[model samples]
Target: MDLQLKDLKGIGPQMLHILRNNGIWKPYDLLLNIPKSYEDFSITSIEKWHHKETITCLGHITSELKLIRGYKKDRVHFQAKIYNHTIDIIVFGRNYLIKEFKKNDCVLIKGTYDLYKNSIVASTISRQDKQIEIKPHYRIEGIHDLKLTHIMKDLFESQTLPIYENLPKELLDERKLMSRREAFYQLHLPQTFEAIDEAKRRLKYEEAFFMHLNMKKDEKIETRAPKPYDIHQVRALIEKIPYTLTLDQKEAVNDIFRDFKKPFTFERLIQGDVGSGKTMVALLAAYAIVTAKEQVAVMAPTELLARQHYQYFKTYLKDVNIALLTRKTKDKDMMKHMIFSHQYDIVIGTHALIEEDVLFKQLGLVVIDEQHKFGVSTREKLIEKGKHKDVLYLTATPIPRTLAMLTYGYAKISLMKEKPKRREAILTKYITKQTIDDMYSMMHSALIRKEHIFLVVPAITSDKVTDNIETVYQEIIQEFPHAPIFMLHGKLSSDDQDRMMENFITTPGSILLSTTMIEVGIDIPTATLIGIYAAENFGLAQLHQLRGRVGRGNLASFCYLISTKEDVERLDMLVQSDDGFKLAEFDLIERGPGDFIGHLQSGYLDFKYLDILEDEEIFLTAKEDLEKIMNQPDFNSNPKYRYLYKTYTKQT
Candidate 1:
C-alpha cells in the first residue's frame, strides 16, 4: 500500500508538512517511524516516587489548576491527590494544562518526580478514561506525544501498511525470525519486552541483509586483461632508492605487483598509518605502470597534496615525464595537450583531473590519495576515464581489520603498519587551558633547539577575536616577542598557501598558525612541536594524522592537545595509544560507523537498524547467507531476493 499521507484521516496539510520534514511522507515511512523510547504506564503510587524517576500515577485534581507567570516563563500548578498522598503537579511553559484540568478531575500524570520541590513535572496529563499498557514516544516535532501515538494507532488499525517482504521464507524459518508484518506490528505495539526484542532482531537482520546485497551488487569482478608491468625495471628502481623499505612496505609492493599480473583489472586498498611511507609504495606502482608505456594518474584531495605528489614523483622518477593539473595551473592548455598527446607519462592533480577537458592517453593506473575524501561516484567517474584500469586507494587513516573486511570485502587489502626506521613516535600530551604557561615553555624550548612549531586552530577567524588563528598568532608573537608567525587556511589562495608552507619549511623556529588544511600533506621535517587548539573537536583519526606531521624527522617531536572541555575521554584515547589501528577501533566504538568512516562511504551501507560494531553477529550472519545465495543456482529466480535487490537499487 503506497498510500500518501493525504489519504490518511486526521492528517492535515500542516501535519503532512511536519511528517515530511521528519522523513515520513508515505504509509511505509509511517510504519518505519519506530518509537525512540517506550514508557511503562503501569500506574504507581506517589508514596513510592523517587527523585528524577519517570513514573505514571492516577490521581484526582484536588485544587484548581492555576496559570502563574514565573520569573522566566508561565507555569501551571495544581495539587493532585493520589492514594493517600497529595503531590504538586508542575507544568512549565505549558499554560494550556490549566484550562484542560478542573477541580476533582480524574487524570493520569506521566512525568519525573522532583523530590526537592515536592512536585511532579508533568510531561503529559490525560483523562484517566482508558488503560494504557506501554506508551511509545516519537520524536516528531510540532506534535504532541499523545497525538502521535493516536495517529500510529489509527494507522495500525487501518491495516494500510505496505506488505512488501524482502526476505525469503526459508531463511526466515531457518533463523526463526518474525514475519515482516508481525515484526512491524510488534515493534510499535509490543505487548511484552520479548516481542520488542524479537522484532528488533528481525528488523536488524533485514537491514543487514539488504546492505550486504547492495554492496554485493555494486561489486564488479573485472574480466578484461590488464596491461602487464615490467618486473625488472620496477625492481631496478626499488634497488636504487636511498632508504631501505620496511617489511610491510615491501610486502605491499609485492601484493600490488602480484595483483597487476592477474588477468583482470586490479582493485586494491592500501591502508597505512601516518608517516608510513605510503607515497613511496604508490610511486613504485606508478613506475611499474609507466615503464609499461601506460600513463598513470594520481589524484589527491587537495591541490597542495597533488603538488607534493607531483614533486615527489619527479624527484624519484627522473626519467619519467610528469605533469601537474590543478584549478590554479595557469598552463592548463599546455598540460591538457601533453596529457592528450601522451607526452606526460604520469599526471598528478586534484579532482580537476576528472574534468571534461582532461583526457588520458592510455591511462592504466589510478592512485587516489586520501581516498576517503572522494565519494564512490567521484572515484567511478575517474575510473571511467580509462577502460578497466587498475585502481589503488591510499589512506593514512588506518581502518580496523574487521571493519575493512566487512566494508571492502570485494577488494584486495594491503596494510603498511610500520613507520620508517628514522621516524620517531610523537610524544603526545593532554593540556587544559590553565596549562598554557607550560605549553609556552615547551614551545620556547623547542624553538631554542631550532625547531619550527605548528599551532593548529579549529578556525581561521573568530568574531570574538579569541581561540582562532589570529588570536593564537598574536599570543605566540607576544610570548616570543621575536618569533616569525605565518598563517594558512582553506580561504587562502593556492599560491599564498604554497608560499606560506614553503616559508614555514625553509625558516627555522617559525610558527605556522593554520587550520586542518595542514592535516594531511604539508611535510615540514623541522616542525617538532604542534599545538592543537580545541583538540577535542577533532576525531581520533584526524588527531593522529595531525600529530603525524610533527614526528616525521629524527628529532624528537611533541604534540600538545589543548582542550577546554572537561569530557576529554575521546581525546584521552589518543594520548594513551600511538597505534592508529587501535585508535580507529576505539573511534569506531565511540562514534558509530557512519561518523567513523565519514558520510560518503557510510552512505553505501545505509543501514537503518544494524550497526557494524554492535550488530557484528547479524552482519556476519547476513554475509554468510549472502554468500550462500550468490552461489545458489536459482538466486536470480528467487522473488524475495529480487525484491530486496530492486528495493536497494531503487533507493540508491
Candidate 2:
C-alpha cells in the first residue's frame, strides 16, 4: 500500500493536509495511532457509580443553565443541577464551557463531588453524549480533535483501506500473533485490557526487530579494506598530552583503534557522562584515519560545538590541515572544495556538511558528537561519506538500554564508566528568593577574586514568565556593578550569540547571562560559579548537562539553582544529588522520554500507554524478541513474526 494519500481512492487535498498535519500520511501510521485510554461515562446512577468515591457522568441537562460573573478566567461561575444527582456543576475558563452547552441536550461532566457554600459543585465539565470513546491525542499540531476523529471514523468505515499483507501465514500461526485485520481493528477499538497489552507487546517487538534487522544487514555489508591503523601512534599521542585520558577514554580509544584494523566496518556508540573524554577518543580515531591517508570528519549538532571541536583539533594538530564548515564559517566554493576536492584532511561542522553536494576526499572515518541529537538519515549520510569506513558516535546522554537495543543494538556497545582522575565534583545548591542575597554575596566574593561567573536564565527574552533573562540580567548587573555582563539566548541572531560567547570566553570577571542554549558546547573553565534561575523548570538531565558546563578543568565549581521555596520540592532531586546516571534514571521516571524521539516526537516512536521508563521489563522483552527474530533465516515463516511484518509495512 502506498504511504501517500494521493494513492488512496477518495483523499482530497484538504483531507490530505489535515492528515499530514496529524502525522497520518499512511494507512499503517493510522493503525499505530492507538487510543491512549478510554473514557467510560456509562454508570447508571450514583449507587451504580463504581463506588470509587469519584466518577464521570454524562447525561441530558434537565435544568436551566445559570451563568455568574467569574473572578478570574480560570474561575467558573455556572450552575446546572443534573437529573440523577443533587450536585450542581460550576464551569470556568472564560466561558469556554458555554460554547459546549446546548439547551436540553446531553453533556459529559467530570469531577469529584465537593460541597461548596452548602452546595455541591462539579468543577471540570465536558459533554456527556459527545464524550469520545477510546480517544487518542497526539502532541498538538495544526490538526485538531475534530479533524482526527473524522479521519479515523472515515478510515474505519471504509473498505478502501488496503489490508497490509506483509506477514506470512505460517509465522502468524506459529507465534499466535494477531492477523493484520484483527490487530488493526483491535488496536483502535480494544475491547479488553488483555487485548491492549498483547497488541502493544506485538507492535513494540516488531519495531525493535525491524530496526535491529536493518542495522545487522547494514553492518554485514563490507565497505572498506582493512586499513592498518597503528594504535601505538594514538597511544603515544595520549601519553605525550599534558592531561591523562580517563580510563573510559583509554578503553574506548583502544577499542576504536583495534576495530579500525578489522576487515569489516566499525559502527560503535561511546556512552559516557559529561566531562568524560569522548572528544579525545574521537580525535584519536580521526588521527588513525588521517594516518591511513584518508580524510576524516566530525559532525556536531550545533555550530558552537562544531567550532569548539575544530579549535581543539587545530590546537592539537598543528601539522594537520583542519577546516570548519558551519553556516557562518565557510564560503560556498570553499565548502565544495573541502568535499569534492578533499582539500582539508578533517572537516568539522553541523548538518551543512552532510548534504549531497559535499563530497569526501577518501573519507575514512566519521565522528558524530551528541549522536542522540541527530536522526538516522543524517547519520547514514555521514556514514556514506566514509566508503564504509568506521563510524564512532559520542553522546553525553547515552541512549537508554532499551532504546539503544531498539535503535543501535546491532552495533557494538562500549561504556565509559569513569571520569578523569582527580576530577572535582560539581557542588550544587538550591536557593530561594529569600536566600538569593546570600547567594549573590558568595558569587560577589568569587568575582572579587577575579573569577568568571556564568549566569543561566531560563529565557533569553522577558516573555511568558516573571523571572526572565531581562529581569535576571538587570538584577545581576546591579549586584555586580564592577563586573561586565553579557547575555545570549536561542532567539538572538547567531552572530550575536557567538559574539557574546566570545566576549565571555576572552574576558575575565565577566558574567554571561544566557538561556539553556549554552547547555551543549560553550566551555568556560574560569567560570567557577554558575547561577541557574528557575532551575526547577528545567529537566534533570538538562540540569545535569548545564551543571556539567562549569566543572570542566578540575577547579572546585559551584552550581546555584535559584528558585522559590514553593519550587524547591520540584528541584529536591537535583539539590540532594549530583550523579548524572541517577539523575537520568530519575528524569526518565519523572518524565517518560516524551518527545526525545526522531522528528521531536511524531516520526519517533510515540508509545501511547507504554512508559518507556517504567516499563523497562517490556522493553527488555522486546529486545530479546528482536534478537530471536534476527537469528531466524526466514522470519516470515513464523505466524507471529509475519503479523508484525504486516503491521509495520502497512504503516511505512
Q: Highest lDDT, which number?
A: 1
TM-score of each: 0.76, 0.67
lDDT of 1 by residue, 1-652 (tens): 4578898877899999999999887878878888898878878765677899998888889998899998999889899988767899988898887777799999988989988887898887888568776777787779776777677778888887556667888889989999998898887877777888899999999887877777776676677675577888988998899889999999999999888888888778898988888999999999999988899999999887888888889999999999989888888998898898999999999999889889987989999998878877788788889876899989888886547755555567899989888887788889987998888998888888889899899888877435788777777778888887889998988889888988887888888899988888877778898999988778888899899889877889899999888857788888888889989888878777778876436434555776667777887787788788778886667666786556545644
Model 1 weakest 10-residue run by lDDT: 598-607
lDDT of 2 by residue, 244-349 (tens): 7777777887787778777888678887777777787788789878777788879999888999999999877777888888888647776677566866889898
List ranges where model 2 is wrong by over 4 Å. 1-222, 327-343, 355-357, 371-382, 404-413, 595-604, 608-611, 618-652
Instruction: Enumerate residue pairs that collide in model 1.
Output: none
Count: clashes, candidate 2: 16
Task: Tell how far residue 320 is off in model 2, in angstroms.
Answer: 2.8
For all predictions, the C-alpha RMSD in Å is 5.6, 9.0
Worst 10 residues of 2 by lDDT: 595-604
